[model samples]
Target chain A: MNQTSQPKLWLAQQANRFAPALFFIGLVLLWELICRVGKVPNYILPSPSAIITAFFNVEFSRWMIHLWATLRVALMGFVLSIMIAIPLSIGMMRSQLMNRILYPALIVIQSTPVVAVAPLIIVLLGTDDPSRVLITCLITFFPLVVSTTTGMLETPPEMIELSQSLRAPRYRETWQIRIPYAIPHIFSGLRVSITLAIIGAVVAEFVAAEEGLGYFIQFSTSFFKIPQAFAGLIFLSVISLLLFKSVQWIQAWFFPWSLPKKK
Target chain B: MDQAKNSAYVSMKGVGHQYAPQAPLVVKDIDLDIHRHEFVAVVGPSGCGKSTLLRMVSGLLIPSQGEVSVFNRPVTEPRDDVGIVFQKANLLPWLTVRKNVLFPLKHKYGSYSAADEKRANELLEMAGLTQFADKMPDELSGGMQQRVGIIRALLLNPDILLMDEPFSALDALTREQIGFDLLKIWREHPKTVLFITHSISEAVLLSDRILVMSKRPGTVLDLIEVDLPRPRSSKTINSPRFAELTDLIRGYIYEPDVPA
Candidate 1:
């Protein structure tokens, strides 16, 4: 009975490993079939083949330029937000007064639409990477602050007691104990904020940038080249996914203990 | 000899704690003297302020209406010579076993010396955790992790070891084994241990004296001296006296709930 079940178990494991890729391919194939058979217009919804063709229609250098533009703004904004959010969260964690003061201000900022503020920021900081980066920072920093604060606060009371018993200084306690404890939550926030960074950059580009995937999409749509716009949209998602995965990979590589344990 | 005995290494005088000005007291009118190298266990039902008593001794909690003094000095804040092992292992998962043990030195002083590292390794070796020194806390078993927590408490060579239910999280077999392990360690390197526990048999097995506390607004009910001969093990638990002591504590803590 053991021998019989072994091969069946191996097969199940193999199937489980390949199922996602298989399902994804099936979805694309079905979409392609539906598009072709239904005589779908390219302007309304471009076929997969047309999208791929349009992706390669432009010179590779031109695509690279736009990709670089969007990627730079997104990453710069992400790094900037991290710089601001972490220390802010630490400040908020260390002082009750700061938490009470900052919470309302943060909520106000979060509630106000970034879209409404983007043009004003573009006008204030000018239509450049700095303005675009600030816009992205505005969008991405809130979750980091909230998640980081929650994580730091969520540190076990016993661990806090351990720190207290050691007679460690408040700064050392926050740095060594609270910050390390908050890494998992901070990473979750980073994963969210990194993707939002991309969206924020695109939103900024929609309002002002001369070059970016968002701009390229807008440019293509204006020219009635829907397939080209679809290609640009694909680039946005692919970059967002890669950024998200990199955050997970960074956690796994540098702080593997933060990841949930496997059975 | 009487003066030395009276001048307790650690003393709490009429200690009481109320979390808020209007709130009811958690533990009140408590008085205890833990002599140098004595293993004193405080056993009570859950929320009987057994842990509150330890916190006061460690200087983590300032008693609202009394004083905790160590070696004739009042404890106003966290004392340097008091090491605490909490209920859970509470090992920092990010650090390896060796690093976790060395954490207190680094935590208190931002950096640990080579000598500190050497001391940490020695403590780990003594605890029989030398082989797993580089392994993460997550990689260790619950029993091993708790052992690491104990070793961490011992790392600083503190005069007082404040253990709040250190072995309660472990399974019965592992808890028993660790109890023996703790006895072996205490014999080698003595510290004034104030252990808080909910288990009466545990209190009987490990302590030189047990402080039984009544339920909340917890007050001291009795302090029983365990005259069981030293070098105690599972055999000690099987002895006739151990049973009597446990029965005595059980009666104090738990009235027979069943209709009798």
Candidate 2:
């Protein structure tokens, strides 16, 4: 009896996993039908089919160029933010003087609007990729710092005592115990910042850049190529989704223990 | 007297500690000597600084007033001679059981040799955790985790092992089982052990001598020696002497307001 039920249970679980995708497809079909039956103007509200056609009509090479430009800025900004934020957070956690001097300043900076500051940064650094990357980095930096520091502080008191009893050196304790314990929190920060990195890059492009998906959206809308503008928006969402999924995959790979075990 | 004085593995001289300079002393005027290759248990009421006394012996905390020494050396900092286990198993969640056992050894000695690996495997075998050695801490039961904690403390071959309520978290059956395993292990490889627990029965079962403490501003009330035969088992607790010693310790813990 158990053997017969096992495969049946497996089949149900697989279907349960795919139920969300099936509902998404049904929603898209309903949207397409509504657009066709209403005879809506393509410029006002393009159907999903029209958007797909617009996406394909653009030469793949040209589409990739814009996508690559946006991706490069976002990726560079994200990496740079991690590089700066982790060390700064670690320093702040380790020394009271550093924390007192920089922590409040960081909170004040974080509270200010990134869009308001982007133009000022562009004026200071030119309308080049450097300014765009800097804007993205600014937007992504705070969450990483906050999450990393919180994780470091949350290292269990018993673990600290254990390390002390072992007479572990300061650097070794930080590297081996505190940092690994903080990894799940750090990844949570990464998940939040990756999405913001994309938004930051786009906002930067809107303010100053001559290239990227953000520039494509601005140029398309100006010419009333509404379907093309929708296509660029779609590409942005696709890129964000892919990056989010990649972070989740890397988290699962590096910290398998954090994942829930299968029965 | 000279031989006993010379063999004192851990000596505490009027040790006292408080969190702040003006705060009431947590445990005061603690003078004790744990002899070499002896199992010593400390039992007391809750918040009686039983853990504080254990911490002082491990050199995790410097006493506010007096000194703690191990093997004739004054302990100003944590040393390689001491191993400590906290109330929780406190195993690193990221490491497998075998790796967690070898963690301190790797940190203290820089790296592990073939001999270290063999010793780790032998410990796992001895604990009957051989099959689960590669598993993570979360995969094991509470009893198993504490067993691993014990093994991790043992790996460095420290002269003194200090345990703070190590078995209090386990269910009664598992606690008894692990307590038996601990006694057997101690019989085979005897080291000076200072165990702290709230359970008077556990103190009676494990230690050569039980130090019962009074309520807060904790100080040793009585040091009762257990005259039970070596290699004690579950049947030993049913013996008349075990009951008398436990009752005697319990009286010190509960009847602190009344004069002796």
| Candidate 1 residue runs with Cα over 4 Å from true position | A1-12, B1-6, B255-260
Each candidate's DockQ: 0.88, 0.73
Q: Chain A alone, TM-score for each of the models?
A: 0.96, 0.93
- How high is the lDDT of residue A155 in model 2? 98
Candidate 1: pairs in clash: none
lDDT of 2 at B115: 92
Candidate 1 residue lDDT tens string, A7-46: 9999999989999998998988887898999999999988
lDDT of 1 by residue, B1-260 (tens): 67765569999899999999999999999998888889999988788898888999988899999899999899999988888998889999889999999999999888989999999999988989999999998888999999999999988888899999998889999999999999899999989999998888888999999999998989999999999999998899889999899989888878566210
Per-residue lDDT of model 2, residues B72-109, tens digit only: 88888887878887787999999999999999976655
Task: Name the Cα RMSD for model 1.
Answer: 2.0
Who wins the DockQ comparison? 1
**Model 2, C-alpha of A100: deviation from truth (Å):** 0.9
Q: What is the lDDT of residue B20 in candidate 2?
A: 95
TM-score of each: 0.96, 0.93
Q: Which ten residues in a row have the lowest lDDT in candidate 1 chain B?
A: B251-260
